[model samples]
Structures are given as C-alpha cells and as structure tokens.
Target: MPVGSITRGTTNTNRLRRVDRWIAEQPALRHAADPFVVDLGFGASAVTTFELAARLIRSRPDVEVLGLEIDPARVRTAREQLDRTRAGDGHFPAGLPVTFGLGGFEVPTPDARRPAVIRAFNVLRQYDEAQVDEAWRRMSARLAPGGLVVEGTCDELGRVSSWVGVTAEGPRTFTISLRRSGLERPSIVAERLPKALIHRNVPGERIHELLATLDRAWRVHAPMSVYGGSQRWIAAVATLRHEGWPVIGGPRRSRLGELTLPWDAVAPV
Candidate 1:
C-alpha cells in the first residue's frame, strides 16, 4: 500500500515552472548517471510531470520523469492523460519521456531504481509539521547518491512559492521564488513555505527574522521599483547578502525574484 493519505489533488499547467527551472540547474539532475526524476504526489493532472520532463530534457537528454500519486484514481487519470499525450492529442510532444504510477513517500520505481531528484511539491503542506522530518527521511532515503528531495508548496497559480532542498545528509537550502513583476512583498512567500517552516514563521523563529529582514530590505529598495521589480528584487537580495544573511546565488537568480539561503540560516530554533 502507498504510504500517504489522499490530498486534494489540485494542480494546474505550468504551476511548477519555477521549481523546475531551479531543479534543472542542479548538478543532481544535470550529472546524474540515470538522469531519472520522480514527481512525487503529482495531483489531478500529469501535465506538470510532462512539463518537468520537457524542461529537463534540455539539460539532460536522457531525462525521464515518473509522476507518482498515492491515490490509484489519480494515477489512473494521469496514465490516461499520458496516453493522449503520447498519441499527439495534447500540446506536449508525442515522444515526451514521462510516465505515471501509484506510490507515496516510499517512492517505488521499477527494479528499485532510486531517483536523482524527487520533487514533492505541495505534498507536505497538508501534513503536520511533526510529520515533515519523517517524510523527508523516507523520501530522501530513496535518492541515488548525491541526489536531493525538493519539498515545498506554491500558490494555486504558481506565482508565489518556496521550497527546501533536502539530501541524505539533511535539509541543505531554503528557497523562495516569486513573480517579480507585480510582487507586493518578498514576505508574501510566508503563506507558501513548506510545512516545516510555515508554522515556524512566528516571532523568535529564524525563519520569521529572515522574512522580516527581507521585507525591510525590499522597502528600503522601493525606489528601485521604478526601474523594474526585478531591479528592486535584486537590490533587496544584495542588501541581504551585504548584511550577512548567508544568501546564495547571484543577480542571475535574484532577477527572477528567487533567493536561496543555507538551511541553517533559517532553521527553526
């Protein structure tokens, strides 16, 4: 039996684009011996899995995507969609390397093949904070050497999102990605943090301090908004790094309204 409960199964096309782009840049996928990825808990549609494969293939031609759902019904639905996709009845390429299966945190793969990356977006939002560690342990254990598990949540439209990158060693980085054009505040991501840090965004928590400081930096750089949101975002992130926030990445990423920090910087106290 699958090791998880049925979620709402809510999903939309291109809703996971930000994370896909980030994942594409990671060495785990780019240099994986198998270049296989698991889209754990893909919901009502297989479109995101297809999209992930489509995006990843550019970096790793042999990239194969497997969409997994704990609910047999969702799995069946995704397989049907995959059939139409293969038949060239959909917008996706007929030869897209994608598949669908029924599984959970156990992350079952044929021949017990471990994945280089297990993307469990929005899968943990409905779980208790206490359950996060165990889920991460179970999922990360299924990763191939040097592999990582990307677990996080995003808004329905995918405009606001945040995730944590976890490896066999443990959580390594926390990232926030947003639509820069009309973003009101970087802290808007607070609502979409992975379950582990969502409830931890209260006073005295390191995550809370990080968000509050980011908001301050954004406000200080509000004048740059006239130039463009991306410019303002870049400036805010630069300020964070200048002030010893342990931020990762450079202008290339901040221009996309994305900022990543070592997990220790925002880990719960």
Candidate 2:
C-alpha cells in the first residue's frame, strides 16, 4: 500500500534530536542483529537524518541509517549533498555512515529487507487521527520482528516532544522528551505529542487523563520549584508512577528530561 501522501516537507537539523535520542535508547534498536533506521519524510534538508545517523551510531555504531524523502527533488538534493560531502575529503563532517533514498511510508527498497527502526518524526502531524492507526500498522508491518516504528513530533527548536514506539504487534511505549529547564510544566508536552494523541488530549481519552494526572502531580510537587524545573519534573513523574502509570525506565533517561511509560497507562480511551 502507498499508505499516505507526502507531508509539507519541513525540517531542521535538530528538529528530531529528541526522538532520535530515544531511538538510541530503545532496546528494539540496541538489541537488533542488523539495525537499519529509516528517516521517513526527511523533507527539504537531510541534515536531521545525518544527525540521526550520528546519534544512533553512538548507541549502535554498526547501525545503518537511510534518509527517505517522498519528494524526488528532495532526495536528489540530499544525494547530491551527500555526494559532495563524501567526494570532498576523507573526513565527512559527522563521520557516521548514511544513505539517502526516494521513498514514502511504504519504505521502498529493491533489496526487500525490513527496517529495524523507522523514525517518522513530524511526518504525521498533518494527518487525521483516523489515518494514524493505518499508518502505524503499515509502517510497523515493515519492521523486522522485534524492530520498532517511532513516530513523533517536536517544537520547531527541538525543545519539547513526545513519541510512540510501535512494534509489529502494536504500540509498546510512549516517551516524552523536553528541555527540562525550558518547560513550564510536564504537561507542555501535550502540544508536541503525536497526532494520534494530541487531539485525544481531552476529557475522556487515556492520553487526556495522563496529561491531567501529570498536571496535578506537577502542582503537588510545586515545592520542588525551589530546586528548579528539572527537579520539579522529576518529582512530578515520580508521583505519576506512584499513582500507577506503569513508569519503566530509570534515571538514565529521566536525567535527560524523559519519561517512558508502558503503553497501557496511556492507551486510547
């Protein structure tokens, strides 16, 4: 299936750093026998994809990263740039191995190998919520068993964001990433969550309930304000887990202003 149409082709160098960082941490990518990450909808510039490759290599140095742009022109431009970068000198700026391809969510490849990680950041925000499930299904289906499909959105400056990690089976986890000091409250992530849940952040939806609960806990931990926003967020998230939100990760991620929760905690209402 073609799956969906191309997006607005918008992108920035660090636009997806948050999600890429999470991808680096995922056991899905860490434990894969052959990790190939797809930068679906890489937009007019391929810098972000290059950055993603560098980031993933930090966690899994042998990882292969491919930048896939729906627009042929974009792919051509990216390939040209990569050609120039590689032709110039023995030193490519980022030093990470990378490739560019012309393709869409179906993730075209003549080799027919499934991707181990598909990082579709900012690709689905323009889509309807109804389209998300199908899109997730299609992308997830292209994953090798135990692989991951990470779909997410972030602020223009890469300050705040959220991502959903889906396996071939379905969504497995949700991770919110932010600049701890720049955030007013943990709930600020509501605006950056994937399209599937951003609109669902209301009265009865599970996502809505999660954000509401986070807000309440943030208030409950207001006294931590004396320490700083990061401390406050840590306290707030601790409260969420205490209240049974299925918090899983340790402080390695927590220190980076991230919290990973089991999918059940915020499963759709």
Candidate achieving the largest lDDT: 1
The global C-alpha lDDT for each of the candidates, from Candidate 1 onward, is 0.94, 0.83
Tens-digit lDDT string for candidate 2 (201-244): 88888888888898798788888878987788788888888888
- Model 1, 1-269: lDDT tens digits are 99988899889989999999999999999889989899999998888999999999999999999999999999899989988888889898999999889899999999899999999998999989999999999999999999989999999999999999999999999999999887778899999999999999999999999999999999999999889999999999999999999989899999888999999999999
Model 2 spans with C-alpha error above 4 angstroms: 1-3, 88-95
Q: How many residue pairs in model 1 have overlapping backbones?
A: 0
Write down the TM-score of every candidate: 0.99, 0.93
RMSD of each: 0.7, 2.0
Clashing pairs in 1: none
Candidate 2 accuracy as TM-score: 0.93
In model 1, the runs with Cα more than 4 Å from the true position are none
Span of 10 residues, lowest total lDDT, candidate 2: 87-96
